[model samples]
Target: MAGGVSNEEVGGKLWIMWSQGVLVSVVQSTNQFITVNMTVNNRCVCISFVYAKCLQMDRRELWNSLSSGIVDSQPWIVVGDFNVIRNDQERRGGRPRPFSAMEAFNKFIDTAGLSELRFEGNQFSWCNNQQGSARRWARLDRTLTSVECITMFPEAYMQYLPRTTSDHAPILIKLEAESVSYGYPAFKFHQTWVTHDSFLDCVANAWEDGIADHGMARLARKLKKLKQILQIWNREVFGNTGQNIQHLEDRLSRLEIKLQEGNNDEDEQDYLVAKSELDLWQDREEIRLQQQAKQTWLKK
Candidate 1:
């Protein structure tokens, strides 16, 4: 159920621990990773906990072992600190990552037939707690799964908890059944919407058309119209705040890579634009979270 390397090992060690509720049997254990077969709720799943080597050359072994060793039809989930990133967007404030490194990591994922699980909380899991420009952040820790694993855990998600002592934030993964939804939800206006320059124009346009009624009847019709228009406007302009931030971050990463290869005025401008847009979305997301917290507190 548990295994790890001693201090004498060159690279870091890995350990797999589980509760009595679940049955676990180690299939393979190495300095880089630990693979186990786990059964819970009468269902079996394969999991790998990895602590990859810092050196790219050394990590190649880890990649090769996992890709070849774990070839099976069982639901599989691989999780841990890979010590490498799949793309430029997974890092910030660090020296530009080598393209070859990213390509290799991505290739490993593709070859292994694994998909990175979507996560919540901080974008980066690891951070150098240095001051000013010395600070660096990267998403070295993550969860990946095979198609069968996704089918088995359709409502699964990972969350990066706030760090207390370590450079890396703790990652918590939840596997639960999907909840059924009923009825249309109420339309709640987000406070961030008012910050956009087109917000006023959008509202004005929605309200400009008059309903052929008076008093309460006219007010009710106008309110419904406004809500419908705002919903569409939100979709077109703002969209999903987190997803928009991610899009901008990815664009900025690509632009940064281009800029690193060779300085280009166009790419530089685009990077700045993407950064600006990303900042705006991040701020909006913060405000939205704050509002949600307040609402939750009020309900409690």
Candidate 2:
């Protein structure tokens, strides 16, 4: 661990990539590439290193290795500096990455699809290791993923951290808890009532034919009806949460008193039943909160 940085470099300064705990190296890298195995979240994730080389090496071998190296179980996030920039914004000094690199990157993206994790933050990862006017930068560092990983943690994102010690920026990524989904439908008490078939039918039946102002009047009337229905629905749904919460508090209080006395017959059975009831109430209360969140979404 290079001064507590937890570094494991392979293949000298020419390259470094870690997958799981296993390290791979190519010491005499005139080609300047290496591959390593690192595990994330108790799963094997592989990284294959490719460097800026003039040689016309086909990436098929490296790509094949990356896709095939691990046992077919864990989700994979293969990433690092490949000396490749995916788009024009990634290049500084207005010069773009080579077409070959972009082509290879698109190929990789096509292989992975929308299941890949979002690579957030400013695109540039490495700057020209020179000083003054000749200096430049490019997006090189990256984190990629397999389909399973994207689904497992949809909020996972990568961002470029400012460089301090090295010319290359550190890639910072955070794993999103499995539960959050960006567009998961929130309960919209308002919208739900507006969209209800019975309400819509009532609105439609109120309109008469052959009147020019009838259209606008009917539309306004329908909206008002929708709003009224939603208000009623919200009161009906969320209004009971207070009752459920109060019931839970009362049960917990009684149970705690029984446990404190430390004396009665049927204590074990009574405690278990009380505990189960408390848990059930808690679950119901949580559902109420989620329902309120849905209502908030609807209001928006």
Candidate 3:
């Protein structure tokens, strides 16, 4: 164990621990975050435990420091109580979050190149143990990863385990994918995958490489070939669009932060361009989700 709340301590402390067999080293351990660098199979991965400050400025500082702590190319995963939420949906029965604060938090994630891991179970990770109007809930706890890490562990997922004797839910991240424990993989398409850069190209190429056949036989052959092509594309080219978008957004956020640090015209221009691209990509993702939701609704 790295650290924990002192018996007499009032506030929380960051703690981190790992199983044996992996080479682990402490990169840094502070009140806000703990960075643990681990190596397995000749690959390096950094895991961070974060307990962010509630104040806006302090939170920004945490993000800045945390972002700088890990290398850009290194596979990093951060899990903890951020004391912040990404969108309004993550919060309930609380005063509306300040737009500036939410934007800054999003920018921090974007700057840090962190993508939220899709979670199962509880959507809200924290709840204020209060009655009536005082009762509020927010997803204060979450797991985020760098794009490199997401690519490294594409099957990684978080399960919000039952909360007991604590306001925050205990989240369990399954690093080892379900596919490993279970045999026979089932193929299902994700709506977000279409937002990927090479999605259309991949589909087009797969469709182009078809054999000459007739009627139902030709359709069956093409569909089978397409499935194989898509599986390969999903594994290699597509990967995860959510992570890809997060990475791009992070790059944009970094550029914006640089603009704030200095009066650099080049950086300002870069930020604008990046922001435009991010918006476009976001629109595509929204459209994909909308289409998928419509299809699902129609089916029901």
Candidate 4:
């Protein structure tokens, strides 16, 4: 892809990394008034003008178009100048944070379920070459991914390095994936089971039974061991059981307290919100528990 293409340029380019024996397919091109789409892995990729006075591709429109026009289902990589900074921290010393822009971009990327390639080295790329107390700068380049591409090619990442000619540093990205899992003391209960009086009583009884015949010192030791075992059991059972009825109960209780906090329901809207959340929580717990049981089995 060339550096001076118009905001509306679009085309394809192949990257041959002989060292890794990989041929990366990148289609570099732009659409109607939209920045061009770059290619890699035979997918729609791009170099967008995010901060221009008049954006060639409005964030929403660009994403919607690309999303609807997905090419072959091969791994994809879209890397180039986004122009928009992701966070306030990107600037040397700017306002606290630009949340609106961050949120807008986030919604667009998340809508596409884009996965950011974690590039090592420098986090920022663009810089103002001047040094006195007056030089200005920005981090304008970035690499993005489609949810599908991340799964197909997990080894992908971006590398930001010094640019000899332009103020903006060049970006290098590698694509790949690695599998992993963590080992921890597994507990036997779910969050829903956490606030259960019966569950608490059962655990308390188990601890008491373990120390019934011991002195204070011995009792404490025995209780500690019992706690560990109980926690492990909980991890084994309810660890992955995502929120359920009990969680909804908490939400409802909190909402009710809020709505009734100063004597009044703001409106039917508040009531409906609370009611809907409550309903989902109520009917979801059993199904959640069953699914949790399956996860527990698989983990074990």
lDDT of each: 0.80, 0.54, 0.74, 0.53
Candidate 1 clashes between residue pairs 3 or more apart in a chain or in different chains: none
Per-residue lDDT for 17-62 in model 4, tens only? 2222223333333442233444445554333323222252455555
lDDT by residue for model 3 (1-300), tens: 223322113244755555546777878766687788888778889988888888988888778878778687888999989988888888777588888888988998887778889897657778665533465778899999888988888888998754434788788888775554657767767676676788888878887885899899988898899888888887686555567667765675455334434456677567556656666666766877887778877997
Ten residues in sequence with the least summed lDDT for candidate 4: 12-21
Those runs of model 4 whose alpha carbons end farther than 4 Å from true positions after fitting are 1-28, 31-60, 71-74, 94-98, 176-300
Write down the RMSD of all candidates, one decimal each: 10.3, 23.8, 16.7, 18.1
Residues 1-300, candidate 2, lDDT per residue (tens digit)? 111111235333443534344434322222344444544456544444445433325454445444445435455566566566667776666465568767776676666442335775445667554433455666667777767666666777886654434677777777664465687554344333343346555445443323444577867766666555545654654444457555644554454344333435565456456556656555655665667777667997
The parts of candidate 2 lying over 4 Å away from their true place are 1-60, 70-73, 112-116, 129-133, 177-300
Candidate number that wins on lDDT, 2 or 4: 2
Could you say which candidate leads in lDDT?
1
Identify the leading candidate in terms of TM-score: 1
**Candidate 1 ranges beyond 4 A from true positions:** 1-12, 177-300
The Cα RMSD in angstroms, rounded to one decimal, for candidate 4 relative to the true structure is 18.1
